[model samples]
Target: MISNLSELLAVAPEEIDVNEPFSRLGLDSAAAVGLIGDLEHLLGRSLSPTLAYDHPTISDLARHLGGEGK
Candidate 1:
């Protein structure tokens, strides 16, 4: 997920702080949609269009999607 975000943001993967709000990383709604599309493709499943808003941070989203435990 961090790799994907870094690619989208044109930043190094290490620069993506997991706890930071995606909006703080410059991910506006449109960008979030684009991100969701990428994630859907990668995950091989449909996801809520508002998923980004629903989980505003990388860690939050990852946890919600069962990527990481609490």
Candidate 2:
């Protein structure tokens, strides 16, 4: 997920703070939607459009997505 966000934001993966909110990471609605799409493709399932808002932070989202969160 960090890799995905880094790719989307065009930044290094190390620059992303898992605990930080997506909004603080400069993720807007369009990016969030794109993120969900990417995740859906990667996970092979559908996801909610408001997932980013619901999870808010990378760690939270990761955990919800079945990853081991930091």
- Which candidate tops lDDT? 2
TM-scores for the candidates: 0.89, 0.89
lDDT at residue 12 of model 2 (Cα atoms) = 100
lDDT (CA) per prediction: 0.90, 0.91
Q: After superposition, how far is residue 9 of candidate 2 from its true place, in Å?
A: 1.0
Give the runs in model 2 whose Cα sits over 4 Å from its true position. Answer: 67-70
> RMSD, model 2, all Cα superposed?
2.8
lDDT of 2 by residue, 9-69 (tens): 9999999999999999999999999999999999999999998998999879878888555
lDDT of 1 by residue, 1-68 (tens): 88888988899999889999999998889889999999999999999989999899988998988856
